[model samples]
Target chain A: MINFTILENYFPVINKDIIIGNYTFYIKLYQDKNGYFSLEVDISKKDTKEKHRFVQFLLGLGKDEPNELSCHDSEVPHFKIDYYQREEEAFSATIYFTFRNIAEEELIDYAKGTVVIITKMLRKYFENEDIDIANLSEVVYENSVISELLDYEEKVIDAFYICWKEGDLIVRQKGKDNFVIKTKHNLIKYLNFDYLKPIYLPLKEKIEINEKINSSSQIM
Target chain B: METELDKIQTTITIPLGLKNRIRKLKGSMTYKQYLSKLLRDRNKLAHNESYIEIQNLVRKSAVYSFGYYKVTFTYNEYNNSENFIFDIDIVEIRNKGALESIEKFKKNMLGSEKLQSYQELILTHKLYFELLEKAIQIEIEPLFSHKSRMDDYDAWKKEFESLGLSKKSFDFDVMRKLRTLENQGDAF
Candidate 1:
């Protein structure tokens, strides 16, 4: 592995993410506490809540495949970097790759291949997207708040819940509704938003918090 | 006499195709009710998604300030369920200096207008998180990974032995483990 400082100086400060198919590729580029620059990437599956099993299969954790010599021989070689699964969630698992201590020249080359491989594999296994490396390039240096809200919108889909002063709001999912907040606060009540009308802001327009405050009618 | 029937009595015309389409929709609700449901559902869907995002953030905790109050969420993300469980602490600015800052923050929020929007946003986020967390109780890699297809792990050694790859890769411990796995049929 070589070290690349130019790619490390700025951009992709951990919060840049792009959603492709049922997976969101979150890229975090940062300098560690000791000022060691590292690039980390994680692919989270939004559909399948699989974890270790997925990682084990991916890392070739334990196996003597028919022709492969070392377990690392099965993976890493083709992608040009070593990786393992980190941060396993119920419906998602983060495929983590650390591009630490890599030269700028080699890092760029390695990153391009990596992006290509990820695009190809996601298309191969999931077949839910027509995305390519170009789709990934835009994920660099996005506005954090919009990205956060957008990420929230993408992940949450349509499943919502509210707990303001108990019986304040509701989300409309079919079948039984489970809006129970465990706190013993007596004033809290759970109600569905379907019955309680509220605006769907994103479906209309994006809300920039700073802009909302600065340009609101009251401020005028 | 103005009766309930008078309130209900109204005539509206719809194209035959739309009327048929509405009739084909499978539910006991009337077309009017269903259309109204769709309209309301747009909002629910937006709120629900924000809600889901907050619940997902249970991987760690989140704190948001609304000037008058600040809500801190500490999540127990160790469970595998639809419900996300968390303890919430609402902190108020009681100190005189902090109270002034809170007032300044509230003023900057642009009084009622921004307050309403922020209120809806947080309410929606909290509502969705609560719903998804309602509960609660509670990989890997790569292109070359194509070769490591997990399904083969249970029996790959037998296949490898037959294929005559490299016995060196399968050490004594690994071989025994593989044999045990082979006999157990993935009991682990």
Candidate 2:
């Protein structure tokens, strides 16, 4: 079960965070007063080598602007890098994935895409670290789904639980307003494509092919 | 014919001059009733003034003060309840003292035990933090890159001037255009 915090003080800011290895991934879905929605993810870690590796990974995605990087294969818009030193000993580099001016109906899809990208990055980070990246991705996916449900003001949230059935996730709300949400994990990868022509094809396949080609190549 | 229930009878020691002034001001009302009315009016005046101050603060909407943050309390006419928005601008939080004050404010007001009751406050605080987080990403960190770019521009300008190139060859307007392009190329 993934824990999600629905911050009700403001306009429906939902936080679904996870920590893997030394990195902490802070994911948020927010709606502004102007009714525009944004999904922001900040991936931060203190290790210097991790920062270098992360930057290298970002370089693989073409740099659209000075600090903005974009993966043409993914549904996510772009990524920005920032450096923070809250304390002298706690310096960290953070990668911020920002999607602004998104519509409410499209928020869930963007949120899912954000989770997928973060999962992909974590999987790369833990490629040789013996960590179960698949399990982590599943948890992140479930957390994102829960966040989406919470965003719709789904009542009886405490009664809800998610379980894996075959290759899909089954979310059941037990008490009043009972319902079940059965979704394929890959459905999240290719929700809707407004700009891209191929709407039905999962973008993850393209990303995986690119990753495979890059891995096989000797280019640093 | 004023009912006794509508008034409270009381006696207190006071200067004779004050008593004479009170008697003259009391007019058609009892002195005790007038004094109570004065107390109520004074309280109302203070309350109204504070409300006005809060409204003004909200209107100003710039969090520029040092070591202090503002929370404007507003009355919801429809619900007949009080609500507040925690307003803080990350750019204006200039000094370490101001940062310390924010830390203390969050600690005292956003403590876990007190937070359950002020869930709205927590949510509002989180919103401000989100804004600040974005500001840090977009504004604060990019400052270094901007500074280095400016420095490069400055160095280039110095080198060009030191070269003693004919000033009449390049128009001032052309130089200004180039400078703008160089400085603003990568700026958002």
TM-score of each: 0.24, 0.24
Clashing pairs in 2: A9-B123
Cα lDDT of model 2 by residue, A88-194, tens digit: 12222222222322343544444344344443444544554456666455224545544543333211111011111111221111132312223334334323222
lDDT tens digits, residue span B93-112, model 1? 32323443434444444555
Q: Model 2 TM-score?
A: 0.24
Among all windows of 10 consecutive residues in model 2 chain A, the one with the lowest summed lDDT is: A154-163
lDDT for position B176 in model 1: 24
For model 1 chain A, where is the 10-residue window of minimal lDDT? A55-64
Per-residue lDDT tens digits of candidate 1, residues A140-199? 432332332233332111211122122222222223363423332311222112211121
Report, for all candidates in order, the number of backbone clashes: 28, 1
In model 2, the runs with Cα more than 4 Å from the true position are A1-21, A48-104, A128-220, B1-188
Give the Å shift of residue B179 in candidate 1: 46
Report the Cα RMSD per candidate: 27.4, 27.0
